[model samples]
Target: MKLPVWKEGLAYPQPSEMSYPGGMTRILAHDGRRDLLPFLHDCTITSHEGRLYLGWYNSTDAEICGSSLIRGRYSEDGGESWSEVFNVVGEIGSAEEHFVPASFFVHEGKLYSLITEMGGKNLSISLDLFQAPETSLDEWERVSVLSGGFLSNSSPIPMDTGDYIAGVWMPLKGDTPAFPAVLISQGADIAKPWRCSFLYDPLAPDAVKIRCPEITLIVQGSAVTAYVRNDEGKHGDLTCGPSFVFTSEDYGESWSKPARMTAMPVGNSKMFAGILSDGRRYLIYNNDQGYFKRGLLCMALSEPGEVEYTKVYKLFEDKAAELDNRVGVWFYPCACEQEGILYIACTLQEPDGVRSAVIARIPVDTI
Candidate 1:
């Protein structure tokens, strides 16, 4: 297949020091001192019943200690403003456990939040459900803890057969590294049985090892495609590498061998793959040249079942020099589209090790 070339002659958005086009780059939450709330990352944004909901994980520091908890905020007016942050999971003295927000979406007229927990002898995934018509932050109920080794921050896509396919990854039992997998829901009831299908196993002798596989699924007709993150860089610089792609013809039951994507350079960070309201396939990722240099985040356009990207747009970039020279400026992007506008949520690390969660709004029609 021929790789798509970057679209030229189109007027791109003017760069700004503090904001992006439409002045939509605004900080939703931040920790200045790194003492009160140390780390804030893995942000996911979604619209539910006309309200914008932002969910992320926070801890005393950047570590996955017992002090980690899931936090959420709601925006009533299209993300122009937001409510005070609140704990979606975990408590003040819950030092022995960790609860991280994995995914949030509405399915079957019900709002659902997936929280992954890690504690002593316990590593499980749980579901929280709220009635769509009359749901509030206080109304969420822990429904069930999904069995098997399924964990991801990407939301599941509803299949034509009425089931949902969630992209997940698990650590290998022995010396092998982790790889991507699919969690097949039984039906509309998310609390029911879920079967697991391993897509790419790096431990196999013939398999291509993919580290930290943050798999995002995109459904096109009867086929489901995955863009797996190749976290490990080939040059040991943790920088430029092609993302691995896989497809499943029989729903999420089976998948094809992984292949390197063309015309796209993905960093060792997470990337998002989703369809726009206009039926165009888009991917948001860090198109940096070196490892941990997530300052350049770009969006590209592609067609269904196509490995090559046709057009590219610069969404945001942080040019400020890193104070410590060890940390990147941007990473962990999560996005969703509504009414032709794309809302992207990501974490911005400051020079002094402080991290803040920010969201950017881009008019999809302009791209």
Candidate 2:
């Protein structure tokens, strides 16, 4: 693999040397002798009606190459032990039709799985929602919305005005470069007919081409801060390098021009950030860069009700970790905070080049 085009110093305190959540449970592993879908990624977590559920897409080898299935597991005893694997979105998907697990959220007393349903219209995708009531996972009913061509990375967040904003991005369409975008709900309803807004004009005269994006938003009153993965390190420097950032003051109605997150070490990877149950802010993403980049997952936090992340912790590393296969890469982390427990689920790559999934359950007080 080629090294990162940009250079930034390693994180101040090394990740491997710090303490991680104790008894981190390995939810499930790919059984070569039994399973058909070997490659899995984009894990999402949410708790509904007294049960905790985690979901991800199990693909063939490359993403969106062939059929992809949304698989998952449930835990009744608060992340202590999880049930055997089961299908969340069992409909078959292919290169033209692919199902990527977006964040799972509950609204109006009903649990919903926001899916990035890709297919048709020459690789078009939309935020597809699904739900299965309390007694069964055998059937999931599809919920309708008034939108298309949008990719959802995280669940919707309620802003100060009772409205919600969900971090999303527009996929590459022709010469247009994909950039960070936002989807805002109207009048406290997270349903269809979203008002979409982009951080930058991708087709502008001086627009810089970027790689794929999964934006994360930090909301405070009328001020909102958004961050996205910088896979193409062509827009930043060693100082405020990597991670692209954008801000809004009127509840995501509009955004400022694209800029790098000031003086932070965040780099080319999908990150999860949100306000904790205790009013503190927490972020989960990979640390370091280059070959071992995604192999090191780290966490950062801020004081209660503060936006600045002053404390950091080394969450996990791909040491000789084995889950039916030697673990190597851990990426695309999605987190959910509930009942004072932070449930972080991520994709785990193995030595054979296939992938698995795991959820790290940590108490808020332990952070």
Candidate 3:
């Protein structure tokens, strides 16, 4: 299969222009000091009980070296306006801790936030349940730590048999490098032990260098298809490579060997794939040639079990020539579908070195 070619202004369901009162596109949060590098990366948005919640990791001084914090904002009027940023987790300016928000999911009538804490070279992943105080969204408590893994931004999927499965990438004890895997839980209960199954081996002699694995799963009847991002292209080329696929027939208990998806050309970055309520499968990713030059953020459509995609939508294009060698444009988009809108939260970078967390409310009917 050949890689799908994306043309400009070819998006379906034509994207609406910025026409809201305060503007459809607004910066959710940013660093106060212009000298510091403010980074808001890999945000997750969820609509629960008639309210919208956006969560992401914020770093003012540096991207990964300094202290990072998990912050959140809420909008009562469907994202038209958001409240002040509230500390979701982490101690502000902690010298020894760097907290990063991973994902969000609601189970058993409670909202849960997943966070990854990085200290030194070790990474600890945990979950906290949000406790709404009487009528305030500012107050939230960290209940307990779930499993200790690495960074996972994919939402957990509830199976028909009542189990839940989530994708994660972490290194095992004594392993040289980490790789992508899945966590199977008995139900929505995070307190219970989760069975861990590594989808691919990182230390295998022939294994490629995999980083920041974003695993997206689509369930069709009894089969579950996983589309995983290969951050580092196979061999020495890192600019452009095919995403990998793993299919499971036994409810994720077993998976087929990883196979290259020649139809999908993904840069060494995060990509999202999920089946929406309208039965259309959508994939949002950077359509660039490879290796961190993420300028064109696009959305592609396909059937449930099909590998080829069409109806390509160019969401945003970064025009900063200075960012050519650096991480370009939009990256790390965490998306969810609500009502008729597909809400995506991602890190948008400007030419002046200002990075922010921006939200795009895309209508699904247009596609």
Candidate 4:
């Protein structure tokens, strides 16, 4: 199906006027300097009861290199202030065993987390589900809520068929070139067999060099739309691709073939999509064409049921002198709405390549 094409990018106002007014920003986790195990990234945020929760991982060297540990923090006052950070998940990732990143979801009024673990005899990746009860927000024990097999960029959302659906990214292995797919949970229980809908085959000979997909899902009424991070750069003319779009009508049982959302610029990074309580659809991403890095974070919104996100916004950038040297690149936004504010948790990739987490609160009415 053909989707509407929106204009490319809306340049930021002079002196970066688009933010701090739209929302307030805060740096949640960071040491005075990049620590011994400095590399940190893949932050996720959500709202439950009346508090905000944030989670991320810190690696020893580069991503998936030495050891990576998952840490978390929370805010009771709507991102105004935060609790002390703690290791909600145990242990650090090693060469023989690895723990990459985590995402959050609320099911049956209870908060749950899905952490992707890349460990096995072959080091094959899988996702394990854990519950963080209301009594213990800072502490979460490793317990089995579901079997692990796929790696998802975000939390799953409840489907109309009394099920749950989430986007999964299968990395490249051997001749496989990395591909995107969706996992629709059977019934209301995610522990049951999930229907995996493979969008494209990574093993295709014509596949690009690398395809690191970060799937973002938005459910409006019965139409489940996916804004995928389609990082197809080569195998064609030299280029960097934008977010891909597709829809699932049968509650994610199946979906249309992925198609690039033209002009929706992005580097190889994660983007987030969700519908506000007021029904406006919003997307948080680094809408630049650069393939490796980005300048700042951006957001685009679509009026209820519109295909194109005409309402675009440039979020605030963390350009502080103390944070290394280069300008701050806010990437990988995971967001959820509470009351009327859209609380987005993201990572600030400093000049040195180490990362830290931050949260930006934006009210819907302000947009």
Candidate 5:
């Protein structure tokens, strides 16, 4: 499908007020500078019961001057009238170096967000889990921290038992390629002996592997599918990118043989995905290998087997080429599909220089 030149809507509203060296600043930090740190990447927009639910990172120093983590945002009038950014995974201290926000969803009358805390090596104990509040968009609070590990880009799939199945990658000690790990848990007890298992173990006696996985649960159909990349070193830096998939039938029990997705190979990282209300699946990713830059965002649809699938289509691509150097490249795509309308949100290098969030609304048929 031919991609559309992003039909820009009202840009995400800037924080009403901020504190700075001179005085209080009321500007959207879209310019790259020491004063602001871009943090609105990896965004998801879900329209439920007439309201829009947005979740993304809130770079700590975006305004006052520090590093921020992922947070939640909401819009009452479609994409207009955005509420002030609220914490989805709570706030981090200045001493904390690696706290990043990712993954968002609405299940069982609550907003679920997964935020990862990376502390380099010593901080190997990364935290990735779900945060739900009464009304998180307005008054965000960390209801619970699901699981912690070296998890960065992950996708949470809800199961029939009110629990969750998530796709994760925990780096194994040394230079071993990050292994794809699966976690099954209920509520917020990640420490309860995770119904966990490592899907793709490169060093294992088994030759097959699944890397960088993104999973979706077809609750009604009782099926689960995971998309992953086969980064088996042999691909080298060229094939070191992403384009792999794995599927599961028995909840989180076992996975089928992985099928290579040739559709999303230009150069991308994390694969953020979602399932439409009608049961169609959507996968959002970026071509971030830097060859064409991270300007392209692609969406693909498919069933369980991976053989029969919709032709990969570029849903949204970064047109802000001139501002690439200042704001960096476009990446971190999070998506939400409801009632046939698919919402794709991502971060981009604004012409002013700072990194800000931009969104695109597309019909599922367009994919």
Candidate 6:
């Protein structure tokens, strides 16, 4: 089928702005330090009581401060307005806990917020759960913590009867360097312990680079996708690599082996995936995989079980011209779906040699 053209929306230089860059949307909140640390990572956006709630990580200093916990920011008037950014984990100055914010879901009228914490060998690495405020979007209470070292980039899937199935990133031990891992959790309450492991470790013949995992439980099917990079020899090198997909029937309990989505998994370094309002999948990351080459954000359509992909179109194929190497490049693509719209938020390696954030929106039907 000929996929519909995806009309890309405006990009934001800062989070909280009166309006977006292209004037197509409004910026809800800005971190104010555009040239310093970028705000939010592994972000999840959900609609509740007609307002949009965003839970993400505020990276004060990637190499120093670690991923600080940021609270939910709400917008009732669609994308026209936004609330002030709050902190999820109460005021704890310089706690030394790296919190990677993740998925949010509501079960039995209670809002559950999921985040990952990494505190080196001295600190515990696990998933932290918080309960949202009863009325106002002011405070979030700490509920529970899941044990594990590499519990990050989690996507929670709510089952039919109200139970939740969470797909977590589980780190593996090998010579492939350090990356995200894959884990699974199933329970009625948010505090219950769930099983976690590597989703797939298929032989790549070269290297295994899987990070930024996203899983979706859809109608008549189930699917999982992630951003992958082959930095075998180059540990921190960012280049377009390849993307892979796995299928499951029993609500993500067991996945159906791995399959390559991109034609070849050799050159690309990034391939961020998101399920659209129309069931089509969209991705944003580097496409070239070549050293120093620019990466383009793209969108595509896919059938849940089918291995072959279709409608690969570029959203932004421009090189990160303003990126500062000292601060790293503008990367890490994550998307959330709400009311038939896909909101994508990512970081830009700022010109001041720091990290900054940019967000954009697109209708699901447009893809």
lDDT of 6 by residue, 1-367 (tens): 2111122232211112222123222132344363234444445666666766666666555532544666556677765567767667633355567666566666666777776665642243777777787766556776777546544443565556445555554444445434433444555755866566455553456434543333332322443433344333344466434445455555555655454443532233333455555545544544444553433444444543333343444433334322222233435555566676666655544445444444456666555
Instruction: Give residue 311's lDDT in candidate 1 (0 to 100).
Output: 61
**Over all chains combined, what TM-score does candidate 2 have?**
0.86
- Tens digit per residue, CA lDDT, model 2, 1-367: 1111111333455554566755444444333335577777788788876778777777765676677667777788776667787776645544557777557777778877777777632265667667765667755767666367777778777776877788887777877677778888775555557788777777888875666777888887888778787766433333224677677888888877677653456757788887888888777877745523577787777778766666677655775343443567778888887687887887777667766666667888877
lDDT of 1 by residue, 261-342 (tens): 6445666778888888777778777775676677777777755545445666665565422222324477788888877678
What is the TM-score of each predicted model, taking all chains together? Answer: 0.84, 0.86, 0.82, 0.86, 0.71, 0.71
lDDT of 2: 0.70
lDDT of 3 by residue, 288-367 (tens): 55577777776777654454465566656654222233333887877877777778777777666677666667776666
The RMSD of every model to the true structure, in order and in angstroms, is 4.9, 5.2, 5.8, 3.7, 10.1, 7.4
Model 5 over residues 72-181: C-alpha lDDT tens digits? 56766545456666655545565355455566656656656566665543244555445455543443454454565645454466677666777666654565655666
- What does candidate 4's lDDT look like per residue over 233-284, in tens digits? 6544334766677787766667776666655655567888888887777788
- lDDT for 35 in candidate 2 is 59
lDDT of each: 0.68, 0.70, 0.65, 0.69, 0.52, 0.50
Cα deviation in Å at residue 366, candidate 1?
1.6
Of 4 and 5, the candidate ranking higher by TM-score: 4
Instruction: List the candidate 6 regions with Cα displacement exceeding 4 Å.
Output: 1-40, 64-67, 90-92, 121-124, 136-139, 160-163, 172-183, 201-240, 262-272, 289-295, 303-307, 317-330
Candidate 5 positional error at 345, Å: 1.2
**Candidate 1 accuracy as TM-score:** 0.84
Model 5 ranges with Cα > 4 A deviation: 1-35, 47-49, 60-66, 89-93, 121-145, 150-155, 187-194, 205-220, 230-242, 263-266, 287-292, 302-307, 320-328, 350-353, 365-367
